[model samples]
Target: MRHVLLSLGILLILTVSSLTAQVPRRSFLFKDARGELAQARARGEMDVLLVIASMPDQNEQVAQAIAGLGGTVQFQADEVDYIRARVPVDGVEELVSHSAVHSVDISITGSRAFGMAADAPVLPNSEDFSASGILSEAVNPDTIIWPPVLSDYPITNRYSPLFDIRASEFLDSNPTYDGRGVKIAMIDMNPDPLLPELQVATDLDGQPIRKIGVYGTAQDLEEEDDGRWIRMEDMVTAADGQFTYGDNTYVAPKDGTFRIALFHEARDSLATFGGSLENDVNRDGNPEGSSRLFGVLWDEETDDVWVDTNQDLSFADQTALTDYNDRPEFGVFGTDDPDTPIRESVAFGIQIAQEKKLIALNLGSASHATLVVGAALANRGSEGRFDGVAPGAQLISIAEGGSAYGQIESPLISIRDHGAEVVYFEQSSNITRNYLLRDGRLVPTVIYERLIDRYDPVILSPTHNYPILGGIDDFVMARGLIGINGHESKENFFINHGVRVEHDDNLLITGGYGPMGNGALKPDVISPSNYVSTALGFIEGRA
Candidate 1:
């Protein structure tokens, strides 16, 4: 019996050892890294390359693999393992299975490759060979910048000069609206306690303004300073349940001409960074507020604006203030404000333009219908909105609006019917594909070309697929009818397409996509969209 037990114990020990040994420890390498990379790019997947080598023999195998893969090889002594080519999706598993491969890592190539600031570490095993799991540790401008502001106005001195020239020429003979005394409505997640340095307060006649009322839940006022606290109170009383004042009066600053009645809805109670005001404020133990800005009432009173602000501003009052054929109105659309239905918001804008008799309307909205409707209203004027490129020009959007082509067509048709002077369409390639279908073609139709020839409508479509820039930037550039690529980063590609570094801005072979002027010198110049800090929403106690 003792002898049998001893034999069983030995067998158990052997089984355990074999199990550990069977766990693959060595990394493998692929001979053709470039081929794999190309394959991944073709498939539109993230590229991952695995290298398996020890400190002693880094050069020989790494060099051979890179050369074999038809790619340039650079070596760092600090990196002891084998160097592997980063190939996109399909080829990753095949590369991992290669006899020479030890482990795989990802590297982005193409135009974004030169600009990448950091490198990824090598994975220890095939099980950890998840291209999707790999995350970029690098910080991007968008990451550092919050509350993106649209400062790329063609007339602005800071950014593009060509656009500035065009704007000056257009506004020279035209009557200036000045947005003075114009009541502009803005729906935001929260109000910035600090009024922006660039905040304009002029009335239509170019007067100054003061005392902008802001309203939110009672909890929204916690920790707010004295000024913000008073503002919040006034705002709530003006819009909240069953509250009425004879006439909501506001004092405009000398340079400020308009009174802004801002309304916010506390969707949740959470105080963290997002959601309704009813949710926890800190997401810690503290209770806080979450609210979203719904809509703004410009110079008119429409049922939509009234419903959003819960005020009796009325369309007639708006019409009395401004003439649609004489003044210009502008709209700025935000990508994050999903709560507000873009269609209703845009319809409200059209109504405001019609009532106010404004010369031009500049609107920004998220959904496709908003862009379409906004364009239609802008086209209503005889002299058009601006009398320049968009002469009688009206609607300008950041992108073509939603993902579907049908949605885009709705706005396009609206622009045509309304006799829009010009309209700018901005979108990423992926967004465009979603709109233009896989097999669809975008040949220039006669009417479309005629509009382009007459109005010079600019479409800023980044062939590179990514969300580096927000929708507002697109609209600003489009309005000026200036074509330019804004921000380019390898991380954006990784975030959008799994294939790392396969294609980049540099890949625009015809200089149409490169640093220099690409696509008929369309992107006339570059503007800064980095580290920009702007007001997000109003915090109760914060200013």
Candidate 2:
């Protein structure tokens, strides 16, 4: 009897509910709300109105309008207001004609007046709403605790590693030259201070290797000189024929040959001294002898260092020297001249190398103007172009957009006039956009080719998919140095370029990614670049 009664009651309730179901529920309709917003915006009734409703339905109309106006809608809410939208404000009348709005208000975005009028506050948290709070609380614990991982791998080929050395049978005979004392001038937008490996080499005892002079932007020229220069000369004479290194002891060559290192600020001083190595001999009236400037050293502690000697020192002898400047410059381009200051630095560097009678000059900063001028003159016609493949054997660099070809050539000519035999133009810049008319044939101007022919320059053009890094194609073409950055792609490029392309053993290359894998090309030589930390100025860091 109870079961029958319950069944009858359930049937009666169902019938009543079915009849009542004919009436719609009194809930907010999304379409209706959206229509209302459209009408308000169309009527120009809202100054800063944002529709904060569900996606798909609520945002559909607004999105359409924004799209038609050539504006983009970002999904992220954190920075919605900060984003500027270029909209057709002139079409306000057509927008106000839409009908689904209940009210419209006009006010500045984020203004108290706008918020108060809308019965809300500026910068309202989405969590402030009950519905949003409930959703937040209902999130799955696992989703919150362990968010999906985002890849953080560094982009491949952010930098190029290079190996450099002088052309000596002893150094060239070996498969790998350790770059023990070869000075490499690095011209870049900025150099980091933490890169210790980029600086002078240490003695076998692992102490910081000091040089004769350290130069760059931050260094202050010394007002006083210790007897170090005199002592070094004395030691050189005492050693009879060979150079020796000891605690605070640098021996000059016994044959009246003196080696001194110059860099950044020191380059300026050397140029000012007319390319002569300045050292008080016998506390005499003036410094004497045209010291042979050989190499350029760049490091985090010291911006730049140049080394030179009077006698033809072997590569090993030059490598054994260290920077001894108390106040070392600390940047790539250093000068007080506001206009063309950096260019002046390069000019000064070249002048000093010339005066010192260096066999090879390592210059930082490559100016396209210099290369272009050389090319234009060599080709004789605007349509024809030429370039240098190690023009005069001086290493030059082009880093960043500030590079100017016109500004850099005079210095290059100066270096060439000196004993510099091979010049490497590293770094690329803007080339002529026009097509070259050659024998009535319209050909794209080969900027690099022209430059090479003009300067008779040796060029290193690395074409890696990675930005700011060189690729394998660059290494395959030449017998000179190779620079590799840390990246599997770049490492592979370096390896292939070194092993398969150039069989020369004296190749010097540096950077992270030491040899790994079956076909990996072990670095024939390595020097600090990316891994070596160094101080950087604001612009340098950006570069």
Candidate 3:
């Protein structure tokens, strides 16, 4: 329910600064505003807010003044003394005259830009097909019975989202208006060849249905991993005594010792990246029963170094609870006290949590834009559950990996040169920011929102993020009903966070069900999904 994003060095507390001090516009301070205003005007938007930056101590007074001036504040960055608010269109000049104002510009936006840089150093390269999440192997295709024949929930496959919008109906009704002649353009890093269903159809506009193009963006502008996750690759391969482990003690040997590099044997295995301690190296569903983070112990007699799977300084001992205390005389094992939970200790539990947190802060999960395109355009083969709308239509894909101006402009060059009718985007957010190069330095910036003309396919999933919340629920689902370790149930079931308790008898319970905003559009639409396992054939390896 609370923000899971934990930052270490961020101290955003209020601090005083001189009222006369001027804060120069920095790229990180604000989004590209001038360009955004131009887009809003071109798109016919009215009463758009201008994000304002003020002197450190002037934020409060400026906010009150803005409120008095009929402007509603959307966000306030206390550490930076910035305010994003919707000011009156008629009083822009007058509001700019406010003494506390340092800079006034349109509110900018940021996006994941679809994963890491093009030459991403990580193993899951940007071009990896599976990273697209589009061409994933379907677990259930045939003989997997789906949704029961309920009264109101009749057959929905092959005729749901498309039929509701009459695309499929038109396809079945008449070929006259079919997308035979249309030249649709799509951009992605990797695209599956036109599916079998579209193999025969030709476009009426003399354009091929399988048209493809490439757009050039910055190769590796992404500075860090932003996936908010931790994987095996993120772990340190080598161990140093100078570095501290989770127990606040040095991981280093007495003074001159070093632990041999730790390596994840399952680096190439599917379904890894659960951070270290929380990772199920053995895949036994006993994640907390043991830890995967190992230290290297030198086998003096064998003349070899062995991986200490547990943080304990022993060789050839299993990391599981079963063999956790086998080498007690080495002082590396716990007291084997039945009363104390081994997982509760820092070396075993808290340290892993800290490592995982640090890892989540550094990972950059792959983008699924091409994946979305695959779900939207990929035609069904023998593995039938549902077919994308207008399977006969042509497609063009380009990988826009960066948010630079050249990167943003490169696609339009391809679109214009190729003569495209439809464009597909899966960058997650609608708005993207651009840095304005001024004088010689990159200063103020503005973000641009994609404008939907009559032709572009603007598909979106209707889901509000509760990422951490969902992870908690998922953990409970896998482990069973979590018992209350320290609090009440009616209101805050997730109070203790992820501390799990063992119990029998399966039961599903909802937490944070307190009334907030009761009504919202339910049943989000996922163009491509891996829900065949959960919802049967209704969403089988579907996209």
For all candidates, the clash counts are: 100, 76, 21
Q: Judged by lDDT relative to the true structure, which candidate is superior, 1 or 3? A: 3
Against the reference, the lDDT scores of all candidates come to 0.29, 0.27, 0.34
lDDT of 2 by residue, 1-543 (tens): 999999999999998775333112112322322343455568785322221211212334545555665544432121111111223334332333323111111111111211123354577566534564544655566656332332233223322222322334543475233322322222222122212112333233433343212222111112112111111112122245444433223433233334334322234333322122232111122335634232232221222233432223332343322221233332222222333211112211211222222212222222222222121111111221221111111122212221112112211332233222233232322211011111101000112222233444343222211232222222211222243332223343354343333333322232223232223343333332221111111122211
Per-residue lDDT of model 3, residues 414-474, tens digit only:
3444455565433312222122122111211111111112113332211211222211111
Per-candidate alpha-carbon RMSD to the true structure: 26.6, 30.4, 23.7
Q: Which stretches of candidate 1 lie over 4 Å from their true place?
A: 1-305, 308-400, 410-422, 433-458, 465-483, 486-543
**Top of the candidates by TM-score:** 3
Residue 305 CA displacement from its true place in model 2, Å: 18
Candidate 1's residue-wise lDDT over 1-543, tens digit each?
999999999999998775333113224322233444555577775534333332233446545555555444332222223332333355455544445443342322222221223456875665434566554446355665433333322322222221422455555566453223322211111222212222223334544332121112111122211111112112222332223223443211112112234433332321222322222221122224423432233323322222222123332222222221122221222222434221112211222323322212112212222222221121112221211222121222211221222223322433433333333333323222221111111211112232333434343333233443221211111222344444433444454344467443322221123221111223554422211122222222111
Candidates arranged by lDDT, highest first: 3, 1, 2
TM-score of each: 0.28, 0.23, 0.30
Error of 1 at 474 (Å): 17
lDDT, candidate 2, at 483: 31
Candidate 3, run of 10 with poorest lDDT: 471-480
